[model samples]
Target: MQLLLVFQGRKLRITVILGAHNVRDREQSQQRIHVRQWVIHPKYSCEGFKNDIVLLKVGINTSPPAHLPKPLNLFLVPSGAECEVAGWGRTSLTGNGSNVMREVELKVQKEKICQQLFKNYQPQSMICVGDDYRKKGVYKGDSGGPLICNQKAHGIASHVPYGYVYPEVFTRISYFKPWIREQLRKFSLQDLPGSPFSD
Candidate 1:
């Protein structure tokens, strides 16, 4: 799969490279899509790892082959909720990444537990999920994927330590719903002011 980024009415391709191990044939499995636009949270910070979420405006050139979860509108995911996470990330802690996307079920951990585990964890902006007992969770290469619960996007996979023992961190969608709506509104206004596709 590929991520599309449209800037100033020009389409830019962002390749999504997956490992070859999980695929039957790597060359034939590659895919691409055209994205109309994308907006990252204004308060996002790479240094402190805060507010790690982005909203993508996909174009109508092609529709997703499979059903996609819609964004959760002002919905708060409760602790212990079983959520599904899918990605082409590493299968094991010591293994190379996977070529085919894999999906796994994880339970959302309490905010207090996450804060205790991660010193820099921001409770208001983040959520944690994993199977600590089995050491199973999101690892390297899984960043920016969605955390789906109840057929809605509740979080975005954000961070995890080197080892897979700790719970994976995710950007809480509920906390930033207003910001996301605002950005989408701004984009709509800019594009609809006259010729919708005008540069």
Candidate 2:
């Protein structure tokens, strides 16, 4: 169990390294356990910012394998896609500190709310993940967490609009699997024979 330490700000984060990130096909990469930690979601590319994006593919400094241009290949799941959202961010608006790192299930939103929220942006490239105002929304510290759908990662916790209130946002992984692989291979790979996403 080799641990890779990622330096951010004044703290160091750890990552478990295993195999060459190999897959029988590109689709396999989509099902692999999402390991994107502190990268930026390319959606903010307009600012000439790259590292600010958090991704499910690899570290914040890199991009997915060239072939996998889709930032989130698994992000846009079929209707009725059941997913889980996890984080160590915040449990409430006024929590003195982050809540215990946790995971919660959320149904992908399909209502017109999705349409209305992005009336001024590129809505097709992005997907909505939460509607439960009481629970499952990302708060102050839960950035770059994984959103798993069907036991596979679907998106990365990216951002929330209007102060983490009603609808929160996530970076779709379904659209970016191929490119993610390209960017991640340079880091390190893991060979989990019976791992959850090894199929």
Candidate 3:
């Protein structure tokens, strides 16, 4: 199956690794895929942080064969739902980034909470996720990671307020499902025979 990936616009990197557990280990099943193209949201902005998402196309070449994870369909994530976020980011307020991948369980906060916390919070496009006690949350270098809930990617880590605050903002995946579908359809056609963009 062909894999089309999505992530936060600002997190576009040179490459992505699949089946990676430890950041420092060169696992036998791990595959490094170079980023080939990035389709940023038309309305995305650095200041307001609205529509802070991007579609990614990657070039895959691996020895011993490698396959990407199954793409999860977007779905509505309920408030107070349990979810997980993983990344190789800092574990503490004063610690450096970790060499091993770490994951933290968080709860999806209500839109009312986000609206109260952030001036630019958009209920239709953003999700509030973190622990109520401000204990569990994504740290630096965790931006653009997936907020997985119910076996699907319900959101993309958008931004965290200064001082590592609780209830971080995330780009709601369900709200952009139409735009994502359209982009995938458009890109699929671009790879068709006789298309100038086709390889």
TM-score per candidate, in order?
0.75, 0.56, 0.82
Backbone clash total for model 2 is 42
List model 1 lDDT by residue over 3-52, tens digit each: 55665699678543333335556565454444556777777777547988
Residue-wise C-alpha lDDT for candidate 3, range 1-199, written one tens digit per residue: 2344446555435676888888788989788887667688999988758999998766744544221223343336778789888998888778988988888899988788888878889978888888658487887888898888877777888888768657799898778877887987887887789998765
Which residue segments of model 3 deviate by more than 4 Å? 1-13, 60-75, 132-134
**Candidates 2 and 3, the one with greater lDDT:** 3
lDDT leaderboard ranking: 3, 1, 2
TM-score quality measure for candidate 3:
0.82
Candidate 1 segments exceeding 4 Å error: 1-12, 15-31, 61-75, 193-197
Please identify model 2 stretches exceeding 4 Å from their true place. 1-43, 46-76, 118-121, 132-136, 185-199
**In model 1, which range of ten residues has the least summed lDDT?**
61-70
lDDT (10s digit) by residue, model 2, range 17-130 = 323122223432343232444344444553312222443333333334322223533434754567777666667777743424466677677645655764432344455667
Which candidate leads the pack in lDDT?
3
